[model samples]
Target: MSIFVRLLEAIGIASASAPPIASRPAPVGPIMAYNALDLSDPGLLEMMRDGRIGVSGLSVNERQALRNSTFFRAMNLIAGSIGKLPIHLMRRNGKLTEKASEHPLFNVLHRKPNDYQTASRFKSYMQLAALLDGSAYALKIKSRGAVRQLIPLARRSVKPQLSDDFVLTFRYTRPNGTVVTLQADDVFHFSTPLSLDGLNGVSLLDVAADTLGLTIKAQQAAARLLTKGTMARGALQTEATLGEEAIAHLKQSLAEGYAGANAEHDWLILEEGLKANAFGYNAKDSQLIELMKREAEEVSRFTGAPRPLLMFDETSWGSGVRELGLFLVTYCLMDWFVIWEEAIWMWLLTPEEQKTFYAKFNEGALLRGSLKDQADFFKAALGPNGAWLEPNEVRESFDRNPIEGGEGLPRSGTTAAAIAQADKPDDKEGSENGA
Candidate 1:
């Protein structure tokens, strides 16, 4: 621990030893409940507007509004590469015979699913990201150029930053070889960046968040490689804490909201379990990511697209549900901070720089935040008796909460919770499904 602390001190990062303490105290993610804040808060509304979040690249407020919007949910469904409707659903003589039924408990969940194909999911997501008016945008993104300069810098081996946002940043280590440290500026697009050199700053928080995200993505890929064909083991474990934190945060919001029910003081920042910012990764996200990567690779093999993934920006799709007197907006940054790191690393990032970027950019934030919405959907479906729900009843209550605002996700919170508890401090899950 002392040697690790010293290395981080070399990178001009001093708060190295204390980040863990700060993370533990963070409030959990909020729950969806009807309140006026849904309509009043510009950030929440912005998330409702666009279907995707640009993270640092776009306006945070607008992204917030876009998250609560129903339009994005409709779009996300149709963005699949092949087609929207399941192949089985589109059989030769299959007709739209049966009208989709609405759930009695929640009126919103009964709505018909939408499927609009997007031109380029990522770039279209970039359009949504354009909403961020401040810095975090850039041009002439020649990854090759950044790698050329940064890779050599890694070999020199200066003092490590020791921040939680490190690869070696987050329970990482120096492989027994020449070290190469590379920082990603792509996620750090600050419009009209200070020097006009397109260079913005890297906060310890941002770096930490990025590391978590990268860890999830890379670890997911690794898991896919490690497990032949089995349910994702790693994801289940990490989700335990992730779910607990989320529930705790939401419950706090409920208390605040209930306490001030008659007053205008409607919202407060829910404590986040994720320690880092945008690229933050918790143990649970990594576990699931391990499973997701294999799912992604399987898609690659099946589609022959080299690598293909059915991406869902659940966190950005929409906000909390609002009804007659109740207006709920679960303000969770549960959206994927960065998806497809392997593709990003292989195609966008250089070979040499892949190590650092993979561990850094994505790890800055947690991969899974959409769990809040799933929980919300369950609460909504459970009527006013969410607390009394039984195990199967819980499953039944969630006839299926679509991802964020889309299709049915993993079916039950149990599955999601199990995965969240799986991520380790080092983000290294045991090889349970060692095929």
Candidate 2:
């Protein structure tokens, strides 16, 4: 029995036969250590391969720290927005087929991807990790030569390899001290800013660390002030003489009484001619808010996320919101959509099937506007002078069932030329009356 069969059986899947092997003894070549660690940095790859490095800077830990931040949480809006979109499978003739979309492949992707996480969670994690780490992996689970389900692998545990024959394989470390190798055909490796050699992706954190780190520091400083009462450039002064121990006791007492949310508006009695004075402004100071806002704006610019989408600017109203939404869908979301769609198309469909089948993200669904706005847009689209879409076609977009006889092209209002032609007598009738 092979290790894969044992694994499947351990997962409660009854396996009757051994899995088929497609790999030709990985051609005795140099093993590549293409992990999440920035390969662009020399020696890091070697260190990771030799187990010399463990969670360095910009590690998965840093990614989590960013998630914990206020401004960093705003970045998640991009991934969350795009990840929930529906992926449709279509044929070469541009026909969407239920067979393809309802296939087990999509069922696993759209509903239950793994035993632990839903499709939404899997997609959200995959997209965020890919954005931060520049690469994400999904291990293909198969039984008896057929793919059963896709399991998302932790970005931290996967080190990929590109063999001389261009065969991609991954070395994944499990939580129970077991290691498994997966073929490229068995794994869905999604990446962004894919390198020219295609061996590894360039981490966005590596490129934008200075910016992200600054925001992180600001958050930490604010947390310290809020929780530990370390007010910026402020200190307590006393006129009465006191022993060193008493002074230390007073400071600790003040901190205990006036720290965190519990300290709001709480009065403190002082003795020995001690008076409280505040020098620095509170955290609500516009300057600090502006600084954080500026940093957030810069991060949004780098990520191509709309400022309005992140709630950075509240002044945008009505059409501004629509325009910003369009900008997000066009400039930011579409790029990621294309990346995911291409990856799915290439991997889910074989070479022969690729000629006829493809995948696409439903961009129209994301680009939809308000009810009134959509109605007006559809009216213009269905107008006879500029007729583009039929009434039924428009209704289908709103998920409303098409009406009978609604497929015909609409007619334009009466024109002066048409009225004149109607009033004129027929030439053949006039000639027959004369004869």
Global lDDT of each model? 0.31, 0.66
Query: For every model shown, what is its TM-score relative to the native structure?
Result: 0.15, 0.65
- Which portions of model 2 show Cα errors greater than 4 Å? 1-60, 67-71, 94-117, 142-148, 194-197, 223-291, 314-318, 408-435
Instruction: Write candidate 2's Cα lDDT for 1-435 as tens digits.
Output: 676556445544434553443433543654222242234765345334422222232332344436644436555776787668766666655553433664566566666778888777888888887876778888888665545677888766777887888777888878663678877788887788556557667666655655666666666667776898655635556877889998898879878988788888887788777777776666676355566666676666667766666665464654844676688788888778888889888876678777876676776766676777786677567654657766788788878998876776665643422333333467347757889
Model 1 bad stretches (over 4 Å):
1-69, 73-124, 127-144, 147-338, 355-435
Clashes of each: 97, 0
- True-vs-predicted CA distance for residue 365, candidate 2, Å: 2.6
* Best prediction by lDDT: 2
